[model samples]
Target chain A: MVKLAAKCILAGDPAVGKTALAQIFRSDGAHFQKNYTLTTGVDLVVKTVPVPDTGDSVELFIFDSAGKELFSEMLDKLWESPNVLCLVYDVTNEQSFSNCSKWLEKARAQVPGTSLPGVLVGNKTDLASRRAVDPAQAQAWALGQGLECFETSVKEMENYEAPFRCLATQFLHLYREKVELFQGLV
Target chain B: KMKTDLCLSSEGTEVILATSSDEKHPPENIIDGNAETFWTTTGMFPQEFVICFHKHVKIEKLIIQSYLVRTLRVEKSTSKEPVGFQQWIEKDLVHTEGQLQNEEITAHDGHATYLRVIIQSAFDHFASVHSISAEGTVVLNSS
Candidate 1:
């Protein structure tokens, strides 16, 4: 079984619950803080996910970065050499959803001429009554951008692991492909 | 009595300890006096490093160039060996993106042979210290 490690970055606008989503996935519903403290820099968390049937595991070093524009320059440094990306937005905030493209552009710009695997996540699904971004629309945009899409709610603990698990699976697939290519060349 | 770069390894300064060390970005970069080179933290919070000068010096000001640094605490020791550190300065730094944080702090009473810098916290998962310049004159009488 192959054990791989990769850097995963989470980016979004401020107040969009980026930190909450990360905390929920890391703690597995054991911890949740009600008080909100603006993340001025990047918070690092690590988690391991097992690939089904293959017995291989991937350890993800997740970098949860601040969403404030004032910290945009510092954010770029944190995005260095990311293996996967998690572009998140608040479902109830259309502006956050609309800003997804901008965030994606910035992340992609960091690694020019390379295609990085990523997911487009619409968070705050618990606020469905006040939702402004339709899942279908978000999914369509995500597909257009070549990213898998998922809706999650940190507050409700709904499908919080889907995005991370998907990333791990995709990374493992890439790792296998690289190993095969090297073997074939030999 | 001209000002000298007291932290330079070429000038008899030594990086005694750094909690997190990456081969590409070694702790010596902090005193290299070059902004292009840097030492990056590998993991976790409260990463720290110790710098020992060849002799006791009276530091007047310190300029640190770094990125993603949130809270920084500095201490000094006058003993022959690296021990008995006393708090000199502690302050929170502002975060700026796409640019290095050039922080200039006035260190009024930094008379010591060893200086310790403790990064209490950072704005991000990892932080980088590009360079640290200590402007002061060496104390001739204080061996």
Candidate 2:
């Protein structure tokens, strides 16, 4: 049994459903709510998901962090252990989307050890009618960050599984291929 | 009536609370030149933190710990506009023994776009802000 630990960062505004999304992906019977108690410190939750083809179970340690400036000191600690990053933003708020660059910069500075793969999540997509962020703009921002972006609605569960599953799959695939290549050389 | 007061942090930018015991490392104190901050409820001690969200919000209860805040004020801005601000007066020392105390103040007419907390003048310790958690609720509504 291959044991792999995956770390994901849920970076977004206070009530943009970052914690809700993490809970949905990581735990069973996770409920979605309108109001969430703002995360003051770094919140850590772990979940195990099975890879389809390989049948290997990957344990994901998801960190839902506070977006306030007071918690900046803890970024290095969170970055040190994370294998993947999820840069979340609110679809209804353009400023949240605009701040994505700042959040990305912080994440990059923390994880200098590896080219940490990131997923741009436009959360609360169910409120797209009131969306201030256009898909094209969000996509362009993702391109500029050299990361893949997807819009998700935790309320409606739209494209919910795609973002988490895609990131997990990519990490597993790359790890397996690299190990095999190194073994063949040895 | 032995009542306990629990100070909690609200979600918004501007205005923070600090206890007398937490002076060395307050909430919004960033390191070096890197300005980064996070909001937290659980720490060494409990103090009430209030932030003025530029947008209107519905708050149910105002809970404070280890502190007796007599007046709660909500101002439009830092400018000295006396008309728009509101305050409440009370005489409750909510703490008996040196333990974590919790107080619940539910609002029947307490809805605000901005919030500020003023502890009774005798508490000895003041509040501190960690960092502003502005989620752009201001810009979107104004625009």
For every prediction, compared with the true complex, DockQ reads: 0.02, 0.01
Residue B94 C-alpha lDDT in model 2 = 40
- Cα deviation at B76, candidate 2, in Å, is 65
For model 2, what is the alpha-carbon lDDT of residue B68?
A: 20
Model 1, runs deviating above 4 Å: A29-41, A67-69, B1-143
Give the alpha carbon lDDT tens digit for every residue of B89-141 in model 2.
Answer: 24354432323234555554544555544343212112222222222212222
Among these predicted structures, which one has the highest DockQ? 1
DockQ of predicted candidate 2: 0.01
Which tens-of-lDDT digit does each residue in A1-186 have in candidate 1? 555666788878888888888888777742322222336545777777777787776677788764544476788777886778899999999999999999899888865655578999999988879999999999999999989999998898999999999988887776555333322321
Q: Which run of 10 residues does model 2 chain B get worst, by summed lDDT?
A: B30-39
Give model 2's TM-score versus the native structure.
Answer: 0.49
> Positional deviation of B134 in candidate 1, in angstroms?
44
TM-scores for chain A over all candidates: 0.89, 0.81
* Model 2, CA-based lDDT: 0.53
**Interface RMSD values for all candidates:** 12.7, 23.6
Note the Cα lDDT for every prediction shown.
Answer: 0.80, 0.53
